[model samples]
Target: MSCDGDQHTMQSSDDVLPPPGDIQVLLLTLDSVSLSWSSPQGLIGPQTFRVTWGCDGETSSTRVKDVHHLKISSLKPGEKYQFNVATEGEDGRQSRWVSASLSTVLPAPDQLTVDSVDTTSAAVSWNQSPGLDHTQHHYQISYRCSGTEPHITTTSSPSITLCDLKPATEYSVTVCTVLENGKQSQLVLTTFTTVLPAPDQLTVDSVDTTSAAVSWSQPPGLNQTQHHYHYQISYQCPGTKPHITTTSSHSISLSDLQCGTQYSVTVCTVLENGKQSQLVSTTLTTGSCPEGWRRFGCSCYYLSTEEKSWEESRQDCLERGADLVIINSEEEQTFINGFEPDSYAWIGLTDSVTEGTWKWVDGTPLTTPRYWWSGEPGGGTYQNCGEIYYISSGQGVWRDYDCTFSQQWICEK
Candidate 1:
C-alpha cells in the first residue's frame, strides 16, 4: 500500500490506545469515592483518561491527564453507582471502556427520638439515611438501663417499641442502619428515663363508721433506703372533694370520713422529679355504726345490758360519748318500745333540775305527744326522773321513777 506516497495514512487498530485495566476502588465513603486503575499497557505517550459515573439515571464525567487515580465527590450517600474508564490518545482516538460497580457507605440515621414512655416500655424512632431504599434496609437498636448490660434487637421499620424496660430508670439507646449486604452505619445515640411504676394490690384493710385503713404492695424494686420517693394516696366520696396524703409506709389509716359512704381510693408513686405513676384504685363502703352499736335513722344507739340507777346510767352514757336516749318522735318512741317490750329502762326526760318541769338531756323542754301513764307523777318529789314502763299488756308508757331506781338504760349519739 503504498508507502511510497508522502501523504499521511490512517492508523491501524493495533495503534489505537487500549482501555485502562484493573479498575480498583481504593476507598468509599458516605458521599464520595476514591478510585485508581493501571494505565493501558505500554506504548502510550501522554495519554488522558476519561472517567464516567452514573446513579439513579443521572450521569457525570471527568477527564484527567497523566494520572492513574480519580476522586469523585458530591455523590449521594448509600447509593449504588456504575463507573467506566477509558484512555484517550493524542490523535483523539479513545480505547474501549473498562467498567466497575460499587456502593457508597451508608450514613448514620438522623433525628433519633424516644417517646410514649411508660413504666415498662417505650417507643423509639428515627429518620433513615437518605438515598437508601426502606425495603432493602433494616435498623438495629441497642438499649440498656443504668448499670446493666445492653440488649440488642432488629426491625425492618424505622420505628420500634421496646418492652420490659425497668421503671424510673435511665436508659441509653443507639440506632443504626443495616444494608442488605450486612454493612452497618455509625451508631446514633440518645437517652430517656421511664416513668415511675404504680403501686399494686390496693386494698381496704379495715373500715368503720368514720375511718378506713388501706394498704398496698410497693412498686417493684423500691426500697426504704431510696427516700427520694413516696406513695401518694387520694380518696374521694360522691359529691365531695378529693383528699390527698403522702406516706412512706405501705399502709395508712384515713380518718374524718363520713359514715355510710362509698369512697374511691387511688394510690401512685411519686418521684423526686415530681413525676407520678399510673393510678391504682379501689372502692369501699363505710359502716353506719361502730362495733356493738346499732344504727337507726341518723343516730347510733346502744342498749346497756346491766341494770343501774338513773344517775349511774347517765354517767356510763357520758363516758361512752353519748347521752341518755331522748324520744323526740312517735317513730322513736315506737322503736324504743319494741326494743324491750317487757322491761323498764331510764330515759333522758327528767324533772330533777326543777320539780314538775320535765327536760331532756340536751336541756330542751319536753313538748306534746307525751306518753304518760295514768297518775304517773303520784310519787311527787320522791320520783323526779322519768322512765319507760311496760305493763303486763305490753303497752309502753312514761312513768315517774326515783333517781336511784336500778334499771337498764339506752344511750344515743
Candidate 2:
C-alpha cells in the first residue's frame, strides 16, 4: 500500500469476508454475561471489543480494550438489557457491531423468615444471592425503614443481626450484588428486626442491720442482648423517712437500724431497651435490745451510774440486779475509767487495809492496773482505795484515795 498526495492511494483489503461465524451473547449468571465468537483465521493482531450495556433502554459504553471478550456488571437483577461489541483496526477503522439482546438475570426468591423481636430490636436471617459468581463478585446488603437509597452492605455470612433499633420497629432490608468493577445489582429487600430478651429473675437475700441482698438473671429468648438487672431496697421506720438504695447488685448491708424494727425490700430487672421488670417485695425484722442499755455478747445490761465508796458501790450494784463494774483486766478498768472523766467514782478494786495489796469484792486478786494516775498507790498516809474518776465524757482516770471518801460510781448488769 502507498500513500498519495491529497487522499493517498491506500490498498483496499475488502476481500476478507470469512464465513459468518456465530458471535452470541448469553446471560450466564446475575453478575456475569458471556460473549462467544468464532475467530477468523487471518487477523494481524489482537482484536479490541467494546461492550455497550444498560437497563430500560439506558445504554452505557466501555472503552475499547485489546481483548476478544468484555463483561457488563452492576445490572439490576430480574432486569433485561442489550449489548453490542465492535472490533477496531490499527488505522482506527472499525468492524461491524455484533449485538445480542438478553435479560440480565432473575433474582432468587428471598428466604424470608420471622425471628424474635423485643421492645427495641429484631433479628433476621436470609439466603445469599444466587446469581453472583461465588468466585469473582461479593454482595452488598442494604436496609431501610422505608423506600430509600443508601442501604447497608456486609460481607458476613448468609445472615446479619442488627442492633440499637427503635422499640417495636419494622425494618426492610435488601441486598445488592457488587462486582470488582464497583457496579452494584438491584436491591433485594430483607424484612427483619431484633427481638427483645425475656424478663429476668428477681431475688433478695436478707442481711444484718436492716440490709438485704438482691440479684437477677438475663432474659430468655432468641437474640437476647444488652441484659441487666436493676435493684432497690426501701424501708420505713415509724417516724422516719423510708431509706432507699439503688444498686445493680443482689445484696447490700444496712446498719444502725432501731432494734425491734421492720423493713421492706424490693428488686427488679432492666433491659438494654430501658424496659424494666416488675418489682418484687419482701419484709425483714430487726431484733431488740434491753431498755436503757444496748445488746452485746447476746446479753442486755443497764449502763447505770451510782455514787458510793468501793464497798458501798459493790453493795449498790448487787442490790440493783448488777455488779460493781468488775475490773477483771486493765482493759475493763480503763474502759470504766474512760466512761467519765473529771469526776471521781468507786471501782471494784481497793487495798485500804493492807498497803501494796489489791482485791475485788469477788475476791479476785488484782494483777494488772490500768491508768494508775499520777503517783498512784503512793503508799502515803492518805491514799488507800482505788477511786474511779472521770476526766471527760466517755473518758476516765483512776486514783488512790481514802476508801471511805464519797465518790461517783458506774454499774453494769
Candidate 3:
C-alpha cells in the first residue's frame, strides 16, 4: 500500500492556514474603536477567529466565528493600542497572528460642578476622566450669553474661577479637557446666573416723633430681566438688634420709633429666587424731644437733679428750647409723680405777675376750681412760685412756695 504524491501534499496543506491581514481601523469613539480587515485566505467552513488587544501593559482577547471585522473594547483614550488577530480552522489548525496599532479618542471629564458662585465671579471644579492617569491635562473653558460670541480661557488645573460677569445675567459655560498632545475631549456644559446687585441711593427723606421715611433708587444700568425686584429694609436703633421690613415701593416708612433717637437703616435687594443683595446703609435721626427729654402727651419733659431757685430752673428750660412744665389735668399731675418721695419739683405755676392770683408762666390762669392743695395759695405774696409733691405722695397737688427757694424742677416743650 503506497500513498500517492498528490494525496500526501494535500494532507500537509490542510494542517495549516494563512492568518488575517491588512487590519485597518475604520472609526474611533470615546471608549471603543472599530476595526475592518481582509479575511484569512484558504480557510474552510466552521472556522473561528482570535483577536487580542493591549495598551500600556494591559491586555484583553476575544474569539469569534468567521468575522472579517473585530471590535476591541476597554481601550484607553489618548493612547496607542497594539492588536493581534489570527484565524482558526475546525481541524485544530491555527495561523500566525497579525499585529497592528490604533489609538482611541480622548476621554471627557467627569463630575463638573460649580463649587461657588457670586454676583461677579464663579468657581468651578471637575474630576479627571477615566484612563487619563499620568497625563498632563489642563482645562479650556468658555462662557457667553445666549446668541453671543464665547469667551475662551485656559488653566493648568481642573478647577477655575471666572470673574467680571454681568450681574443678574444668565450665561452658558462649557469646559473641555486637553491632553499633552493637544487632543481635546467632548465639551461639558452648564448654565449660570449671576446674583443681583444692591439697591442704590438709599437715603432718609423725612423724620417725625415716632417714625422716619426712607427712599431708594433702583439699581441703574439693569436690563428688563433684572429690573424686577422687591426691597428689604432693615433698621436698628442700636446696631446689635435689627428689625426688618419688605416693600415693593421705592419709598417706605419705618414706624414705632422713639423720639430723638438715631437709627441706622439698611436696604437690600430681594430677587425672584429669594436671594438678597449686599446691604446699603444710612443713619437717620427722628425729630422729637432732645436727647435727655422724654415726651409725654403734647410736650417733652426733663427733670433736674441739680437743685436751683424757681427762677433759675425756669431760665434753664428756656435755653433748652423748652419751658417750665404746666400741669392742666389729673393725668399730667400723675405723670410728674414718678420722682422720688423725698423730691419736690417746680412747675410753671406762679402768681409772680399779680400777688394772690395763681397763673401759669405762659399767662394761662388756673381757671378750674380745686386745682390746688387744700387751703393752698395761702402764702399770698411771700409764696409766689408753685411746686409739686413729685413722688410717692397721697396727693401730688401743688403747694405755693417762695420764688427764691431752691429745689429740683421739671421742664417741658
Candidate 4:
C-alpha cells in the first residue's frame, strides 16, 4: 500500500490486505509505558520493524528498532497516548501509521496500603500521583469479606476502609482509581477485614474466704489463631482490700485474705493486637478457720481457765485435747498478756515436785522467760508447788504454793 496525495491504492490480489502487524498499547504503570507490535510477515525472513509512539499531535517521538516491543518509562499518569509501527523491507520502507489510536491504563492505585485493623474498625491509608498537580483524588476502596483489599484506584483516596464489619470475617478489597478526568480504571483487589475482639468467657476456679482463683478462655472468632493473650484480674473481699494481678496464664493464687468473707472477682482478656475484652465477674467464698480459734502466729491457742494452778491448768487443757499454754517468745507473752483476766491462770512453766528448776509438762526448757512479776517463785521452806496469785498490786505473779494446799491446780494436755 502507498500514501499518495489523499489516499492509497492497492494492487489486484497482492496489496489488498492492510499490512499484517499486531499492535498493542500496554500501560506498564503510572510511571512508565510500553507499546508493542509485531508483523508475523515483516517483509521477509529477518526483516526488522521500527516502533514509535508519543502523545498524539506532539512533535517529540520515542523510537525502538529491530525489536517488536518498545517500553517507554517516565510517562505521566492518566495521560492519553497513541502508537504505530513501520517495517524495513527489501522494497525500502513500507507503510505509514497503520493501526488505530490507543491509550495507557490509568496508573495503578497510588500510595496503595493498609493502615490498621481493629476489633470493630479498620484504618486504611494511601497517596496518589494526582495527574501533574497534587490534589485530593476520588477512590473506591473495595474490600473482601475477610482479609486485605487486593487492588486500589486513583479517584479514591490513597486509603479508605469499610466500616461496621463483622469481627473476624475474611474480606477481599481493591481501590478503583477514579481520575479527576472522570476515568474509572479496573479494580485493584486487596483482602482484609476487621479483627475480632478478645474472648468473653471468664470464670473463677474457686473462692476462699480471703481469696479466689480465676480463669478464662480466649475469644471465639477469626484471627484468634497464632496469637497469645494476657490476663488482668481484679477482686474484692469483704473486710479486706481489693487486689489485682496481671499474667499470661489463666490462673492466679490470692493469699492473706480475711476469714468468712464474701468476695467478688473479675477477669479480662487481652488480645494479641493490644485490644482488651469485656470484664467477666463472679462471686465466691473465702476459706475460714473455726470460730473462737482466732489465728495468731499462724496457730490457734487459748488459755483454758481464767484461774487455775499450774497443775490444775495442765489437767484442764488435757481434758480439752490441748496442752497447757506453751509460751514461745516475748512477743507471745505480750500477746497473751493482752487477754489477761482478773485472776491468775496457770501457764506451762513450773518447778513443782522439786525445787529451783522450771520445766514444762512437755519437758521443754524455758529458753526465755518474759515478765516474771517482781520477786517471783520465792519458794519458802515448803513452797515447792507452783501458785499463780495476784501481788499486793493489781499485777499477778507465780508463787511456790504447797502441792498439798488444794489450790486450783491448772492442767494442759
Which of the numbered candidates is closest to the native, going by highest TM-score? 1
Tell me the whole-model lDDT of each prediction, alpha carbons only. 0.81, 0.55, 0.76, 0.56
Instruction: Compose the digit string of candidate 2's lDDT tens values, residues 1-413.
Output: 11111221222334233311345775466655776665544665566544556555456766445555555555655455666555545565545565667766654325744465555555566566575433355656665664445447566465555655643335776665565556565666656544433335545444333233444454443232423445445666667788776665545566656545676655554554565545566666655433555433322234445455666766777886566565555545546655553367766667765777876656677775466667766776656677666666443566788767666665564
The total number of steric clashes, by the backbone 3 Å criterion, in model 2 comes to 36
Worst 10 residues of 4 by lDDT: 1-10
Local error of candidate 4 at 377, Å?
Answer: 22
TM-score of each: 0.55, 0.30, 0.49, 0.39
Task: Give per-residue lDDT, candidate 4, residue 248.
Answer: 74
Over 4 Å off in model 1, which ranges? 1-48, 52-88, 91-103, 110-116, 125-138, 147-149, 152-161, 178-183, 225-228, 238-240, 260-262, 283-287, 290-293, 297-299, 302-338, 341-413
Candidate 4 lDDT over residue span 116-154, tens digit each = 877656766665644525533477665555244433333
Ranked by TM-score from best down, the candidates are 1, 3, 4, 2
> For model 1, how does the per-residue alpha-carbon lDDT over 1-413 read when each residue is reduced to its tens digit?
11111232222334367788878999998777899999788745776987778776667777789889988887766668888777877776777778899888788788998868987799998987766753378889999986788999999777899999877888999999887777788899999888787897998888766778999998876655643689899999999889999998899999888778899999999988888888999998876666777777656788888889999999999998789998888778777776773368888989988888999999999896698989876568779888887664444789888889888888887
* Ranked candidates (lDDT, high to low): 1, 3, 4, 2
The lDDT of model 2 is 0.55
| lDDT at 387, model 1 | 87
**What is candidate 3's lDDT per residue for 45-99, written digit by digit as tens?**
6667666676656566666776688665655567777777677667656677777
Indicate whether candidate 1 or candidate 4 has the larger TM-score: 1
Best by lDDT: 1
- Total clashes in model 4, counting residue pairs 3 or more apart in sequence or in different chains: 67
